[model samples]
Target: MSSSRILLASRCATEDEISELVFKLQALLPERRRQHLRRVSRDEVLEEVCSYIRKLHKQVDDTSERISQLLASADLDADVLRSLLQQ
Candidate 1:
């Protein structure tokens, strides 16, 4: 399915709706290739993407905390400000 249709399918889509969409999309693929699509359902794909997003957000939060700690310990002189900019 196109990204537009996928976006429309987001969040509010019922499990039956997603299954129907996936079924239609699968029909366009060659018989042997259909198995690959079946390996991950639409819900599975959504969950995986959400999991990755959470991981990335956590990394951002951790990095920001470390930077705050670095800034807190540093002297607020002109040279130190320049060093922070370089970082």
Candidate 2:
């Protein structure tokens, strides 16, 4: 095969792979998001993913802050705190 045909074939394969991965990512999203994504572009799907990640990070930070506050207020001994943390 000519170089141009080989390049075209490689490009098509790459595109197909990207499409499959995007579909998998969409499937991982919440049902509401997936429904919205049905007619949206790839860029929109990516934006949704970014938004979801930010929300998760916020949740983690909030939870960590709450845990620190609780630990500080309790003022338990080092051994007790270490055992509690292990659990």
lDDT per residue for candidate 1 within 9-87, as digits (tens), equals 7857866887787676566555655555577777654555455567779999999999889888977998878877899
Question: What is the lDDT for 55 in model 1?
Answer: 78
Top of the candidates by TM-score = 2
Question: What does the lDDT come to for candidate 2?
Answer: 0.86
Q: RMSD in Å for candidate 1, one decimal?
A: 10.5
Q: How many residue pairs clash in each candidate?
A: 0, 0
Query: What's the TM-score of every candidate structure?
Result: 0.50, 0.72
Error of 2 at 8 (Å): 11
Give the root-mean-square deviation of each candidate in angstroms: 10.5, 4.0
Q: What is the C-alpha lDDT of each candidate?
A: 0.71, 0.86
Across 4-83, the per-residue lDDT of candidate 2 in tens digits comes to 97899876766678778778888888999899899777788888988988998999999999999999899799999999
